[model samples]
Target: MLRPVTRYADDLSYVHHTGFADLARGAARFVVDLIGPERRRVVDLGCGSGIVLRALTDAGHEAIGVDLSPAMLALAKRTAPRARLLQGSLYRVPLPSTDLILAIGEPLNYLEPDARPPALAAFFRKVARALPRGGRFLFDVIVDAPGRPLSRRAWAAGEDWAVLVDTTEDAARTRLTRDVTSFVRRGRRWRRTRELHHVRVLRTVDLRRLLRDAGFAVRVRTSYGEHPLAERRRAFLCTKR
Candidate 1:
């Protein structure tokens, strides 16, 4: 079930401030701790709205963000005016050599199952070519939770906006389909937007193997913070070998 990669267009607006600021800030702090306060250049792959980029710049580090959504990039530019923002995909983007590379927010999961390995290999090769030895890469993936039923969730922000998400898992529970619908207040009217996202869930062992084959020394943790299992997201810290 290989589907063409879909870009987030109108859906970007719905997620710009989707209540994940705390998590983004936490991830940023963890990154700073790992890299120290040397003010190194950092590139955030799939950096939606520049949340982490803002944190990086505020910490006195040079930061750049790359994302596939122009709408998201626009918001990012406005939010993190100090950081450079680019519109592009993770697979092929012109990026400078950096001290650290971030691909958080389950970016890799967006790829289809068959595309994950080759795409990840190319991603690692690009990072390797764009970084010096010992450079670090940090990313996260959503691990499959078997026996979890189809989940429906909703969010509302006063009278300004509302979102509904319905998630359906494949029989094998290795793939997820997310159907999102958003309603935003505009003047006296409410506008609606809808998007469908497909994602693949990868086990920790699979992720470690990918990183190892890509020439990295990898470490996996349940969370980036001091807590071991605060969230379902698993973080991968890799150093170029």
Candidate 2:
């Protein structure tokens, strides 16, 4: 059986300090500018908790989000009751014409190797099928250089857990190896769970190639937020043909 593409059982508040809401809003504004004001129809692929969806809507765009996790979509609905939210995979989203598609938060890197290409292909086909002559897709990805020392690392406070961080050899992939350490709580209980993920490290070259194959003219810019594209993290700007 295939693994469900979405997972949102835990509280997303864990990653709150990552500034998901602010970052998504900034990215949305950038996409709208690149795609133009007239094209206001947008979709948020892998929209977690509908943060990006909320951001897009606040910017006066007709934005909806599609996520694989029903739990996450439920949270999203609670967060943005007016925004249209869908529970589905990126590989299979049912919708009509859209002017812009945004997928951020390094969501693309979470796909397994074999599932990566096909997922991208399907998403591209959907976007192309929906878009007119000049539409755009903006997404972000993380790159990992295997065997490299940790650049930025942090632990979830109040838990005896350490999050191991490393990028794969290709510099396009990253893995968040969760190292679970146990500590007694109130001298009564213990908690532990190890979450290891082997996700794709999408490379710029391969990503561009895939976009071209999917009928997109790709332009790799450092994020619109002015972050430099390095061996770790960055964003891509793609215009569908």
Give per-model CA RMSD. Answer: 3.2, 5.1
Q: How far is candidate 2 from the true structure (C-alpha RMSD, Å)?
A: 5.1
lDDT (Cα, tens digit) per residue for candidate 1, span 108-201: 7886323343366667778877878899999887775444544546554544777777777677757777776777777898888777777877
State the lDDT at 118 in candidate 2: 49
- State every prediction's TM-score relative to the real structure: 0.87, 0.73
Per-prediction backbone clash count: 0, 5
Which candidate's lDDT is highest? 1
Which candidate wins on TM-score?
1
Native-referenced Cα lDDT, model 1: 0.75
Residue pairs with colliding backbones in model 2 are: 144-167, 146-168, 172-201, 172-202, 173-201
- Give a tens-digit lDDT track for model 2, residues 1-241: 3342334443332233233355665665576566554538788888877776776666677878887767677777877676898877776767667887778776676654233434666666777777777777888886543445333434443442223323223223234432222222334554443333345555577777878988888877666654343445668777877
